[model samples]
Target: MSCHNPAAKIDIPKEAKKIVLAGNPNVGKSVFFNYLTGLYVDVSNFPGTTIDISSGKLNKDVVMDTPGVYGVSSFNDEEKVARDIILYADIILNVVDAVHLERDLFLTQQIIDMGKPVVVALNMMDDVQRNGLKIDIELLSKKLGVEIIPTTAIKNEGLDKIKDALYRAKPGNRIEEVKEIIDKIINKVDTESEALLLAEEDENIIDRHNIKDFNGQREYIYKLRRYRVDEIVDSTVFEVNQNASFKTKLSRMMLKPLTGIPILFVTLYIMYQAIGVFMAQTVVGITEEVIMGKYYYNFIMNILGSLLKDSSLIGQLLIGEFGLITMVPIYILGLLLPLVVGFYFFLSILEDSGYLPRIAALVDRALTSLGLNGRAIIPMILGFGCVTMATITTRLLGSKREKFIATMLLGLAIPCSAQLGVIMGLIAPLGLKALIIYCLTIFIVFVLTGTLLNKLMPGESSDLLIDIPPLRLPRLSNVLKKTYVKSIMFLKEATPLFIIGGLLITVLQYTGLLDSIASGLSPFTVGFLKLPPEVSQAFIMGIVRRDFGAAGLNDLASQGLLSGPQLITSLVAITLFVPCIAAIMVIFKERSWQESVLIYVGSFIISFLTAGILAQIIM
Candidate 1:
């Protein structure tokens, strides 16, 4: 149940106590977690975009996020993790959905039964009021025997009160007896027994000699929770009309077969044109060429080049054609800059608007047939933006099997916006038929490969359990804030990889390793794919960034070396090759080393084979 493995406990930091934000799922726990931790929250959206926990620093103190659970005794994986955090957390923030106060109170009562010091955040108070619900906060606070603060997180309200409450928080005398009883029950059990009890909610416990105790303690706790939740709902919650609203209708419309697929196609079309064409081409062209190429590039190359000229190796590594100085600005500014920024903007709106879940539902059936759950679409959709980010998201997939399949498909089939853009730009000069072939080939590979892997891989499939938030226009301020945070995170993570990649390439070229490698790969290059031997180094550059190889192809296209058929083959190969190094690093982070290596090799072979086949057919 605990996502973190149990190792010998580290000593708590001398300066600060670790406070954990705990709550039921979809109760705005993450939003409160974000607010409490401010800019320090580590935003990890797993592959399915399902249950993720984040940690943030609150002053000198640390705030941990536990996945939402229904109750401490619940069978769900998240529930077990919640109970552990409750037991271990120095302080707890029990977040409750104000609109569904009764349902939220079930988990609250579980935490209360454990006797941890907790403050109740009555989140979504604005929504509660809009539905004609009124809660006597003071009375409810007294009943729960904890401080209750009303918060409308989307509006950024009530955060100050939470901070103030944290400062003043102390263990309540009211729950002392209950806490002592639970602690006694817990401490008496062995680690294995404890885990079993937590996961199975087993009421019976046997000692070392097999003496069983059925003292009615666990049942009594269960009865108490039922009574408390019923009492709270009758007293606090007031749902008006109680029927599906307009937003609910919209949600249904977005998932229905008749309408959903059309909407999805339209959305993808807009996304492609918006990010791939306008951002990557129009905006990036101006930034990279007109401004950077005209001024910054000349200044850096002239100054740095002159200084290091005495040592050719140092000069080339620093400022030559393959140098970090030469490649960083071009790769970052030309290829990544526009697409990354644009994607952040796009992602902000989708996440905030809460339409992603509906889209998942719509595409669920199709994806499932390929041996992937419908929720896997989230990362696949994200792959169009950047494979690195998408690969990191694979953490959301419930099973390792699913993660492996998704990662492999992503590396082999999904082209990031930069590569897609360049392909579209290059192939369009030929005709739309070239574009169709390009797309159809990739889709066929994605499906056939995923299906085969699904059959070959051994593991249980993850049945998708996803939250479908009410459809609403995203708040502009929230969108901007999320976009800004993600953009900063991307730049920080990627810049170093870009610089190092460039420097490595420069070194390889200077040492003659590049030529040797190219010569070795020439058979596959010239004979099968019918590409020039120099294109081997291009493939090497692509390991650093997919778009870097794409830019390499653009250079070949400029020199008129590749014919129409060869151009398409090269494009397909580069696109399907292992996603850039950033993506590979994320694969390592999300999956095991064995799984990541499998994906890397599988993608490498698949890309080359597909390219070779395409060359034969087209030529």
Candidate 2:
């Protein structure tokens, strides 16, 4: 069956062409896929493979990406999956790391030998220059008999041409011996790709065809492909200089303890000023107070007031304090958009510059003490952006123990960026003491939780395995595009959930469930935490979302209902509160139900318990 057939489990249109992206690992295939297919793509396990394959529609054509593999064979599941995808592809867009052509070209040559139309993206052109190497692009293209486009994917350069070059892609140079063998077997196989695989005596293909599975030429074919790749690389790539570039020197500085620590601190300070201070303070005031609060609120109210009864259920649903239309837009556009956008922009630039990996390397030893390798820091850092996503990312951990420990810490302590934005806005008015106390408290919890889990968990974590990308100057166009795409996507997905949360809160209020729950929790809220019963409402909404809960406290603070001590207590409690519903669901998906429940109950108990103690200390 064709890959687009129902057996492949994809819904490609009948007339649509299939373009499969093939590359080795860490060659920027994903970035290229996103650019070609857009931000939101459908990801699923490819048939029986455990690994996921992502595909998206581009105009009428269906573009899909395969797992990065060295060659098309059944040596591993990744290779097997890529082999199958390549066999059925109408065209192959092979992403070759320009810096690693010595290795990448092996795959390129093998794919070309399969008699497939191929377009090679000579990716990481900037990294090639920084490494002081040059590629004879024209000669390489000639050697492979394919169109090779040089692309600096992160810089958003040369990508536009790849889309255009798809039309010009054609079969590359095939080895004479392989071609002769393929010509003999081509009659028995469904495609040229299969014929090449059959020529190499691929056991899987041989079985599928039920032909003679005893051909002894596999080793010869692989040996021939390697020799050809080496010949092509020798003639087309040159080392212009061996001297270290500025980026090289900087990467060295960033990996060393003395320099990296200070650098990390400066980066953190800049991030805080941009996202926490400037965005939380100045920009929010205009978006939240001036535009949405003063202008939009008034405009909506005027229209709603003249049209419907303010006291009716429909009025309460539409124009109520917790109304979907009124509260949802205001909270999303006015409050969260600027803060997330600023943070994502900063994060994009940081990630593009290749500093995030260095940060991981710098903190690897410290993480080891917590029963995790340095790679754990990546998800922890990502937790600040979205614990839901960071939860999913814990799959990268080598052991269940590390994932459990990391998930526990993230759920209990790390505040998402939007929540942090609200926290900063609330605490800024109360001075440095409140800020320090919050940070110190959360930090202590994070350390203690990880340490305790380390001691209690049964297994050991895997050693740090990481690939460090070359450091380079971030491109403005790339950063801005990332920021804009990510921010808009966040809002688009979040708006419906926010509306549901607001509507649920409104219904609970009208039906008295909200008040009743508050009443039940009043003893702890009022007596222990020294907070009002209304604070219970924040915790209730927190189960829906961490930021919504923080925004609830923001509502209380604006109404002058919380004193400095009470505000600090509430913020700390909510900060340590259960992660949002999405994160909880993801945690459940990533781990057993027993582990998920433990995290959930543990978070709630610890959040309140910590706040109660802090309430006495500060209140």
Candidate 3:
């Protein structure tokens, strides 16, 4: 647990020690991390939900919440990060679901072998009890050479004990004894398990950087584990009850191909309607009209404008009809706020019910042909919320090829909630056929591009490894807390960009750059695509931020400048065009400047070419 990296700061307070909440996905690690840190990290029931690390200060100490990984191997990028952190942590608050102890224990064994400071957070104990499942925590603790604290993170139960345990615990040293115990446990494992175990512990088998040798060292660890399994199992503990219940049968049915596909469609339909339609439409409508439209906008414009009336520049910049102030209230209330809350609520419910992995499994074959695995579905689904986050989540994909394709698809095809919200609002009056074409156009592009990318990218598709947890009723407290956190995240991430984009447009309009660019691009807009020159201005706005661009288009469309074909063409072009500034920035951060530029230029070329073609066809 100690490190000689002098630059690395480990501020261990005299009173409290840092506790890291680590576990596989959907095990309430974030809820536990949030409970300890007193900061809301979105805790969804879905696996691969948290791609990037979210750390917060916990009572004078820091608590880091790592993305859930099934193993501590370098097979995937997220797992590698998790492995590195576990290797360096002072203590691992390993959270496992009580109901799915066996499956959860798979990762616990990997952690125990890594020989780091360890504590078992047996989370979701209530679920265990409800299902008539019993775990001998003491026995399990002894078997794994770690402390076990049964918890219900959703209810905030056992958190004090978790805190107390960390406070009292000393920094961990590599457990030679536990490592030997893992050796014995490996003997009982099958060839597959042994291969994985050895590969993880092997010093020479590099999963990230190019390795001199591709030969796996998994067999060596398998031998070591086989030699020690009996002692570990004997010292540690487990109890098995095989009496099948209704939940068990239901869980099986969910994974089966026959019944699962229909269920998945129904679930997706409900999710789209609930999050995309109801939340984006009804809730956003209420907030935008009742709050921002009626109160905030009038007050800001009138009061601020009157105060700065004599200073024409200041008045126009701060409180003009099209200033950031005028846009801020609407942006937050109409697009960002409602979408975050509604999407998170729906996401939390799906996550809690353990349907996410099943969805992945159902879609895995399709994803594989698209150059991704079932796991890629997580980021692809999240792309609807924010491509920036989804871009970061390319780390979860097993291969570089898969990651590249996923990132590209997300950047090119996925429309964030803000974009969707604004688009829905603008096209609402245009009828369902228009909306359907808009939807179908983007989806077809996603699939076609994904299929082509798969053929072009050189690599075997990754095998889908998914864990399906028992379906449980989502706890209301957890749902609300998660939704609240995501809302805050959305606002925090989007607001500054929205304001800056607004300011940039205002400046462009004032400085005549907008007119020059619009004029330059007018041929493409009016002549090529048969749209007004102003639509090209909207495309410029879209590059800065998608919703801002959509709002600008909304202005033109409302003025009757666009016909049906032109509106549809503009929508398609804007959606397929370069990602918003935020997504582009994320791509730059996660990948590189070159990749980001490729995304931007490639998207622009493809979008415009397609738009021109589509305009001709429609015309």
lDDT of 2 by residue, 58-118 (tens): 7889899998887888889888888888888888999989987877887888888888899
Root-mean-square deviation per candidate: 12.2, 12.3, 12.3
The candidate scoring highest on lDDT is: 2
Query: What TM-score would every model get versus the actual structure?
Result: 0.66, 0.66, 0.66
Off by over 4 Å in 2: 1-243
Query: lDDT of model 3 at residue 91?
Result: 72
lDDT of each: 0.74, 0.86, 0.71
The residue-level lDDT of candidate 2 at 240 comes to 62
Across 111-229, the per-residue lDDT of candidate 3 in tens digits comes to 65655567788888776645645566776666666677888888988888987777544322223544554465454333222324344554312322333444444534533444444
Order by lDDT, highest first? 2, 1, 3
lDDT, residue 391, candidate 1: 83
Expressed as tens digits, the lDDT of each residue in 1-619 for candidate 1 is 2223221132336667768887777778777777778787664432222555577888889788888777664355566455555555667888888866656776676666555678888888877645545678887877777888899888889977998797655443233334545555564454432432332344322332233543535544555556666776677554453454666556666889898888878877887778767876688778777777667778886777567883598878767776667668776766676777787788778888988888887888887767778789899988877788888887888677888888898888998866776776677677778878888898889999988987887765665656667678999999989878877777787788878888888888888998898899999899999888878888888987888788888888879988888888898899889878888887888878988898899889999999999888989
Ten residues in sequence with the least summed lDDT for candidate 2? 1-10
